[model samples]
Target: MTDPQNWAAPGANQPGAPYPPQGTPPPGAPQNPGYQNPGYQQPGSPYPGGQYPGAQYPGAQYPGAPGGPGTPPGPGAVAPKPGVIPLRPLGVGEILDGAIAYIRANPVATLGLAAIVVTITQLVEVPLGIFALGQLAGLTAAPGDPADPTAIAGVLVGSVAGSAVGALVSFVAITVLSGMLIAVLSQAVLGHKMSIGAAWAAVRSRIPGLVGLTLLIALLLVLVAGVGVVPLVVLAVMQANAAVVVLVGVLFVLLSWAVALFLGVSWALAAPAYVLEGVGVTAAMRRSFQLVRKQWWRVFGISLLGGIIAVIIGAILSLPFSFAADPMSDPIAGVSIVGLLITSVGTIVATTVTAPFSAGITGLLYFDQRIRREGLDIELARTAQQG
Candidate 1:
C-alpha cells in the first residue's frame, strides 16, 4: 500500500462514504438486532424463507385453501350481493327487511302479480256479494213483523252459497299468486330479476302441486274440526245430557284447535318448499315438517309477527271505507253498493300491497331454516358468485 490511511479500498471511504458506519448494515437490511425483513419468514413460520405467514408466495396456494374452483368466499371475505336477501344466515329483522326489499326490487313481478290476481278475485266476488246483498235486502224490506222463517232461511242459504263461491274463487286466486310470488322470490334471492311471465313459467308446472297441497291442508283442517263437531251435533240432536254435551264439545273443540295450530306451524313452509324444490304435495308437507321440527317456535313467531303486521295494515286500509259504508248508521238501512265497491277497492289495494310481503317472508323463512340446518348460505353464496 502506498500509504495505509490513504490506501482505502477502491470505492470505500471516499469523499462521501459509500458504506454505513462500522457494524452498521446496508439501507435495505434490518435496522435493529431483533428486526427481521418482512420479506423473510422467521423460524416456526408455516412458509418458507422470505415468505411471511399467511402470505402467498410465488407458486403457493392462497390462504384458506378453497376446496374447489368455485367455492364460496371464506368467512371473513365480503359476500356478494344476492338480490333482496343477503348471502348469509339472516336475523328476524333481516328477514323482514328482505321481504320489503323483494317488493321494491321486483315490483313488476310482485305488484303485477298481485294486481292481476286481486282484479280477478274482485271481479268474481263483487258481483256475488252484490247479488247476495240484493237477496238479503228483501228480508229487511218489512221489518215491523217477525220475518218469515222460510224467507229468513232462504236468505241465509243464499248468503252461505255466495260466501262459499267467493271463498273458492279467492282461494284459487291466492294460491296461484302465492306460487308465482314464491318463484319470483327464489330467483330474486340469487340476484336475478324475473318477469311476470318468467315467474309464471317457473311456477306453472307446480301450480297443480300447490293446489293439491292447499286442498290437502284444507281437508285436514276440516276433518279435525269435524271430528269435534260431529260428535257434539249427534249428541245434541239425540237430546243427551246438556252438561255432558257441553263439556265434550268444549274439550273436543280445544283439542281440534290445538292440533290444527300445531299442524299449521309444522307445515308453514310447504308452499315455498313445493314451488322451489319441485316436490310433490305430500313430499313438500313432509319437508316442511322436517324443517320446522327443531325450529318450531322460531317459525311460529316469524309467521305470527308477519300475520299481525298484515292484519294491522289491512285494518288500517279498510277502516276508511268501513266508516263510509256504515250500514248500521245509514239513512237507507242496507248495504250500499257504492260503499261495498269502495270497501272492495280498499281490500284490493291492501292485498296488492301486502300479499307479496307475505309470500316473500315465507319464502325467506324457508331459506333461513335451510341455512341454519343445511348450510344453504354456502350454496347460495357460491351460486351468487358464479352468476
Candidate 2:
C-alpha cells in the first residue's frame, strides 16, 4: 500500500503560483477564502467541500494538509481533525501523540478505568502475595528438621496459586481495558467526549467476546508452547542423555518463542477489532488476521515499540517504590505488609498510566489499518460531519 504521506497533492507545487504564505490570504485572492494552504489557493470559497481549517474551529488543520488512508483521495489532502488525530494515515509519532492526547482529553474516563481495574486486581493479588510470602518465610525459618511436608505443600501451593491468579487477573484486565479504551477512542476520533460510565456502557455488551478473545489467545500460546514442552517431557521419560535433553529443550524453547511471537503480533488487533467492529471472538480474530495480512512486520514493529514504551514508563514509575519497599517479586526479600502496600501504590500508578496508553496505541493501530485497507478515514470524516 502507498504511504498516504507520499500521495500527490495537487497545486501543492504548481508553477507561477508562488505561495501567499500561510496565515495570510494570497496577494490577489479575496479575504473571504481566508487563508488557503501555503502554496495553493482554492478556486472559490475555501474548504470547498469537506473538513478544513475554514470549516473547523480556529487553529485547526489547514486545508490541503494531507489525505487520509484510502479512497476518493482528494485535495485538501488532510480531510480534518475532528479528534485526537487527523483523519489520515497516521505516523508513529502521531499514533504515540494521539494515545497521550486521548488520555489528556478524557483523563477521568481513561485513568479512572485503569485505576479501578488495578484496584480489583490488587485486592486479589496483595492477599495472595502476603500468604505466599508467609509460606516462604516458614520454609526459610529453622524448623530444626527437614521442612514439614505440610509446610512445603503450603509454600508450593501458595506460590503456584498466586502466580496463576496474577496472570489471570492481568489477562482479564488487559482485555477489558483494551475493549473499553477502543470504545473511548472511537468516540474521541469523532470529537466526542466520554465519561467512565459511557466508556463502560459502550463496551459492556462486548465484554464476553473480549474475555473470550483473551482466553483464546492464551490457549493458543499454551498450545504453541506445548509443542516444545511435549518433546522435553518425552525425552525425560525415556531417560535421554542429559546433553541431548538440554539441547532439545533449548531448541524447542526458541522455536516455541518464535511461533508465539508470530501469532501474538498477528492477532494483536483482535481486541480493537472486537470492540470497534462489534464482532464475535472468532470473527474478530479473523478480522485481525486479515488486517495484518501482508503487513506482519509493520504491525509487529508498532506493537513492540508501544510495549517497550509502556514497559519503560512502568519501570520508571515503579522504580522508586521498589527501592523503598522490598521488591514483591523477590520472595527472598521477605514481603512486608508495608512493602506490599507501598508497592501496590506504585503498581497502581504505573498501570494506570501505562495500560491506557498501550491500549490506546493498539486502538489507533486498528484505525490506521482500517484507514489504509478500507478507507475508514472517509467514513470517519463523514461521521464527524454528521455529528
Candidate 3:
C-alpha cells in the first residue's frame, strides 16, 4: 500500500496540471457537456458509473457497499470527499457494532477469553486479600518500640518488600489478562481467529513494548508526585502564601496529569495496531495519534459512556455490601462473608462483561483510522479474498 502522507495530491495523481480544488475537476479538464456528478447515486446501490463494489463517495459509501449483513445506510456510506477513507467518529453504536462482530466471529474464543480474565482476577484478588490480612497481622505483632532504629529498619524493609511484591504480582496479572482480552477482541471484531496458543504467542512477542509503556507511565507519575509535593512542602515551611502556592501547584499537577493521560491512551489505542499490523509500539502510537487527531472528543465520549455504565453497574452490585455494614462494631465490618463473596463475584462479572466492549472500541477505532489514513479497506478486502 502507498503512504497517504507521501502520496501527492490529486495534481500529482494527474500529471502536468494544477491540483483541482479537492473535489472539483481540474481547469480545462475534459468537461463532458452532459456529465453529472458520479457520486450522486441513490442509497444502497452502485454509483451511476457502476464503480467498484465497495467504492465510497466523499460524504459516504454508496448504499450497499458490501459491509456485514444488515448494516444501516449511514454506516455503509462514506462521510464525504473522494481519495480519502471515511473516518467514522467513535460512538456507542460503533462500539456495540464492533463487539457484536467479535462475538459473532469467534464465539468459542470469546468465552475462553472471559474465563481467562475472570480467573486471573480471582487468582489475584484471593491472594491479595490474604496478603493484606498478613500485613495487618504483622503490624499488630507485639507493637515494637517506635524509636528503636533496628526495629524501624526491619519494619520499613518488610513493608517495602511486601508492597513491591504485591505491586509486581498485580501488574503482571493485569497486563497479561488485558493483553489476552485485547487479542481476543481484535480477532472477534476483525472476523478472524487464531488458536489460543497462537494468540498468546502473538502477545508475548510484544510484551517488552507493553511492559515498557506501563513502567514508563508509572515512573512518570512518581516523578510528578515527588516534584510537586517536595516544592509545596518547602514553600509551606518557608511561610509562603498557602493559597497562591497551592493554586500554582494545582495547575502544574493538572498539566502533568493531562500529559500522562494522553500518553497512556495513545499507547493503549495502538496495542492492536502493533499486534496485528506488525508495527513497533512507537510507530503504532504515532499512527493511533494521527487517527484520533480529529476525533479525540468522540473517543473520549465513548470512553466516558463506558465508564459511566461500568460505575452504575458496579454501584448497584456494591449496594448490598454497603448495607451490610456493622455500624455497631468499633471496626464496623462492611459485609458478611457471604456478602463479600457475592460482591466479589459481581465485580468479576462486571469486569468480564465490560472487557469486550472496551477492547472492541479500540480495535474498531484502529480499523477506522487505518482505513481513513492508509486505504485499509482495499488491503482488507484483498487480504480477505486471498485468505
The candidate maximizing lDDT is 2
Q: Per-prediction RMSD in angstroms?
A: 20.9, 11.8, 10.3
Return the candidate ranking by TM-score, descending. Answer: 2, 1, 3
Clashing residue pairs in candidate 2 are 64-76, 66-77, 66-78, 67-77, 68-88
The whole-model lDDT of each prediction reads 0.71, 0.71, 0.50
What stretches of model 2 exceed 4 Å from their correct place? Answer: 1-76, 138-146, 232-252, 327-333
Residue-level lDDT tens digits of model 3 in 1-387: 222222211112112111111122223335443322222222443433323233233332223344542222232455321211122333467565665566556655554665566666666665555454454445555556345566556766765776677567656655665566566654443235645565576577667766665566567656754565566677778888989679867876677667666655555465665545445556656756766677677666666676676577657755654555333222432244444455556656665555555665666666555544334443333223233
Q: How high is the lDDT of residue 4 in model 1?
A: 13
The Cα RMSD in angstroms, rounded to one decimal, for candidate 1 relative to the true structure is 20.9
Candidate 1: C-alpha lDDT: 0.71
Using lDDT as the measure, name the better of candidate 1 and candidate 3: 1
TM-score of 2: 0.76
The 10-residue segment with the lowest total lDDT in model 1: 1-10
Q: Which segments of candidate 3 are over 4 A away from where they belong?
A: 1-92, 104-107, 134-164, 221-234, 314-343
Candidate 3 has its poorest 10 consecutive residues by lDDT at 13-22
